[model samples]
Target: MLSVMSTRDEEIYRSCAGELTRYATGLVGPFDAPDVVTDAFLKASGSSRWDQVDNHRAYLYRTVLTVAMDHHRSSRARRAREQRAAVPAVAHQPEIDYEILDVVERLSVKQRAAVMLTYWSDLPADEVGRLMGVSEGTVKRHLDRARKRLKEWLS
Candidate 1:
């Protein structure tokens, strides 16, 4: 199916994959980010409207965001089920940077996306707002709340 993608589509994929993966990582975490990106690209490439998209980069970003949200929902449901089934017991935890992830995970999805796009991607507020389908002011609000939460958590 990938072989059927037009040269333009391939170009878009190549240029945007790394940034999209990073965005998805912030939304859904590193473990699921690549798969989220892959799924987004696959969906975009397979869409009947692929050739009609005027803004391929924006389309890809939106696709990645949607896929990441779906993954987050599914993961949350799975965790709930596992929690209900498993007996309470201590398990050896891996040494990793939980502090940052913990703070990020506490954010609402929109706030997290806003924070990641604004800071990590270095996108302008207007562009982040466009990608998130919100006004620039709303994006700023999300970022404000996210920053406040992160500050509280880190302190």
Candidate 2:
């Protein structure tokens, strides 16, 4: 069903678009951020609950994060599929590093996001929290827990 966005919704979108795009960029990357933001807005605007959401900005942030994660998962799956297909044709290849991959796979999505935004993007905890729609302290907790898990898993 097609949902018609109210004028207020349009206004909210206009106000939040830049920040949302930046947040998406942090979650995904600059190359895919615009597409991710557009996809997120489409998903959010179509939701039945869009009209009733108390915090539209936060809702949009979460939706963008979700879409970005889905994009990441799909990309990973596609690459894995290609690698598997190539395995039969190329018998001589470097062995897969399953241990490191397994360790990364063990991390929760939030932990991975926290680590990526923190270390990969070089974003501070407060900025990560803003993008993640969480408190700065929550971001700190996620980072601390992620560090501990990585340390334990690697050691």
Candidate 3:
């Protein structure tokens, strides 16, 4: 069934699309960012309370975070399954800055989200907390822990 979005909702989506894509890209990566944004907008449009949202941007951010986290979890599970089936071999790996990606990937989902929202998206801790449905203090804690781990790992 086709669901129609109000003009206000359309406007909100248009205004927020680029920022949300950038935010989602930070969380998920470039390959999946567009899909994640699309999914978030679709969910927002489908919501019965779409017209009632006091903060459409915040609502959209939260939706994108949820969708990206779901994508991350599913991708991790798929990779785990693939790794289990892979044949063992001593192959030389190419040198690259994979350590950064590895460190980010090792973070708990909440910590990763907090770090991305804070540093990559340049969002304030309070806003990141609102987007992640946590308190500002919690967001700070996540960022603190993530920074310490990243520093230690990169050292």
Best by TM-score: 1
Each prediction's TM-score against the native? 0.79, 0.57, 0.76
Residues 43-104, candidate 3: write the lDDT tens digits. Answer: 87788887788998999988898888888878877657755886644553334345556666
Question: Per-residue lDDT for 1-155 in model 1, tens only?
Answer: 33666787788899999889779878887666778899999998789898899988888888888888888887877756865797744653334467777878888778889988888888999999889878999999998888787887657
Clashing pairs in 3: none
Stretches of model 3 off by over 4 angstroms after superposition: 77-100
- For model 2, state the Cα shift of residue 81 in Å: 13
Runs with alpha carbons beyond 4 Å of true place in candidate 2? 1-4, 77-138, 145-155
- By TM-score, rank the candidates, best first: 1, 3, 2
Relative to the true structure, how large is the alpha-carbon lDDT of every model?
A: 0.83, 0.75, 0.80
Q: Pick the candidate with the highest lDDT.
A: 1
lDDT of 2 by residue, 1-155 (tens): 55467788789999989877766654555545677889999898888898788888878877888888898777777656756675453333345555655666656667766776777668898977876878999999988887788897757
**Candidate 2 backbone clash number:** 0
TM-score of 1: 0.79
User: Alpha-carbon error at 111 in model 2, in Å?
Assistant: 4.2
